[model samples]
Target: MKAIVSVKRVVDYNVRIQVKPDGSGVVTDGVKMSMNPFDEIAMEEAVRLKEKGKITEIIAVTIGGAKNEETLRTALAFGATKAIHIKDEGEVQPLTAARALAAVFKKEGASLLIAGKQAIDDDANQTGQMVAALLDIAQATFAGKVDVDGNKATVVREVDAGLETLEVDLPAVITADLRLNEPRYLKLPDIMKAKRIPIEATTLADLGVTAAAAVKTVKTVPPPSRSKGVMVKTVDDLVAALKAKGLA
Candidate 1:
């Protein structure tokens, strides 16, 4: 079975996010960028499936400019059989990205799609579901554990109530959750091999996809700093303090 993994290039999670000085957006210049952490987990899961002989081929696809090839290279190092780069320089919103991905998925005739539940940068948490909707196929989100058997994928997902299990037919979409699996570290040899595999590139227009309406950022601001806490020895004192602050 061929599997398509959507890898999103995002600011590294470890970096402290900085809003743009003019209140336009988050700063990305000179920032450390990496694959969406959740997408890394998704990639790991796809590799695991391939290792178990359940997946015949794994293709990693990412949308962005030339720089996004770095993210695709990492995916290749992780075990993706090939990489596809959808070239788009503009800001790619969720629905538009979903359209781009869905186009690639169909073009490749992939049987399964795996992606991060959310991108760390935007935290939109919408692309995976949107892709499923566009494809008119079954979908499972926030999957903590996934097992593929024949034409069905059994997914264990986390929910507000607790956990939910789903069995979806093949050619379905699944989004990886935090506890999905730990991504393996990249080895120097694998990284070198990944460098040689040319990433196939295409434009959104080439795939008959178009950018959606642009999102205008009114302004950007940081959260207010917290007030200093007061020490209260007794529960009564705590209550009194809360009452003083009009928070009780």
Candidate 2:
């Protein structure tokens, strides 16, 4: 079986994001960029499956205009045999990405598709499900554990109520959650080898797909600043404060 892993470039989780002065979007200038944490976990899971002889090949793919090839190179260093980059110059919406991915998925003849549950930048958490819908395939989201047997997979998902297990057949989509697995660090030798790995690049037009935004961003504003915390010396003081807020 061949597996296609969706890798995304996102703002490094450790960096503090600053919204634009005009409230257009978060500032990316001079910000650190890394692969989405959840996507890393997804890639790690695919690597593990390959190591176990469950999958024959792993293809990593990323969609973006700039800095996307960097992310795909990271995936190659992590053990993906090859990578594909869907080059999009404009803003890529979830549906657009899903369509582009679906096209590649079909072209690659991938039986399994693994991706992050959500991108850290937007956190929409919709692409995996959208791809499944577009391809008319079974899907398992927020997967915590995945066990493959022949053409079927047993997926344990993390949910609000608890963990839920579902069996999905081949040509299925799975989104990796936070606790899926810790990604392995890249070695210097692996990094050198990754430089030589082939990364095929194609544009949205080249794929014969139009890139259109299903959702438009009006503006992006930071959350309201948190108020200072006050220490109460007595229970009565806490009660009085709560009463002031109409919570008592």
Candidate 3:
């Protein structure tokens, strides 16, 4: 069975984002970009499954601008057998992305789909679930662990209440959470090797899919700046400060 893993190119989490002066969006002119951390975890899961001989092929897919191929190449360096780039522009909402992914899933006849629980850039946490809904398949979100046996997969999910176990048939969608596993670092050799791997480029129209944004962003702004910290000399001082602020 083939496992299709989806990765998203996002602003590196470590970088401090700056809002555009026009209040249109975050500045990306020269920001550092990398694979979404959660997506990296998803890729790690797929690599582990392939290593266990549970899956035959790993196809990495992404939807974004032309530079998105860089993210796909990173996935290939992490061990994806091949990559697919959906050439798109502008802000792609979760629903649109899900539609494109569903089309690819059908086209590839893949039995398993893995995706990040959420993209750090938007933090909508909806793409994986939306993909599952679009495909009309079983889904396990925020998966901490996944065990595959033949046509079945047992997933341990991270839920607010606690961990939950779910058993789903093949052709399922699994979203990786932060605790799933640590993603391996890409070596220089792997990066060089990834350059040779083929990354097929296509478009949503080519996949017979249409993706229009269901939501719109009117403006983007930075959060309010934090207040200066005050050093307390003693318990009495701390108590006095809290009491003055009515937070004691």
Candidate 4:
């Protein structure tokens, strides 16, 4: 079996985000960038599968600017055999990203494609499903547990109430949830070796697919500021306030 994991470069979750002065997007000045957390889980799972002798190869792919090569190298340090980068300097729509990934999946003849259930920055949970739809293959999203046997795979997904399991044939897509295995940190040796690994680059046009204009951002507005709450010294005061507001 061969596994392909899709990764992304995103602003560090710990950094404070500020809107650009021009109101175009977030101000990236002096902000640190790191690999998406959920994608880390997906890559870790792929590496585990390879370690178990269940998968023959693990490939990492990403779509973004040149700086995204750092994210791909991080994936390589985690145990991926090769990397593919789809160069797109501007923001890419979810549909376009899915389409581009699907093209690469076809070209590489991947047996399984794993990606995060959603990107933390965009919170767009469409890419994995869209890629599965484009390829006309099975998909299991929000997967908390995954087990592969022979040509069949079983996945346990987290639902609102609890968990649900689904079985699918090979050549499927799986989007990992938070409950998946924890991602491993790269050792110094691996990090040094990853820098020497070659990364293949491709353009959107090279895939014979045009980027689909699926969604557009109109404007970004800051969330409303919260007001201070009044302190109630006693139950009587609470009741009085509620009655004044017609809530009691």
Clashing pairs in 4: none
TM-score of each: 0.95, 0.96, 0.94, 0.94
What lDDT tens digits, residue by residue, belong to model 2 across residues 4-87?
Answer: 999989999999989999998999888999999999999999999999999989999998976799999999999999899998
lDDT of each: 0.94, 0.92, 0.94, 0.91
- Write down the RMSD of all candidates, one decimal each: 1.6, 1.5, 1.6, 2.1
lDDT of 3: 0.94
Candidate 4: tens digits of C-alpha lDDT, residues 114-174: 9999888889999999999999999999999998888888999999989999999989999
Off by over 4 Å in 3: 231-248
Error of 2 at 202 (Å): 1.0
Give the count of colliding residue pairs in each prediction: 0, 0, 0, 0
TM-score, cand. 3: 0.94
Candidate 2 all-Cα RMSD: 1.5
State the lDDT of candidate 3 residue by residue for 1-248, as single tens digits: 89999999999999999999999989887899999999999999999999999998999999999889999999999999989999998678999899999999999999999999999998999988988999999999999999999999999999999999999998999999999999998899999999998889999899998877689999999999998999999999999999999999
Give every collision pair in model 3. none
Per-residue lDDT of 138 in model 2: 98
Model 4 regions more than 4 Å off = 236-248
Measured with C-alpha atoms, the lDDT of residue 96 in candidate 2 is 88
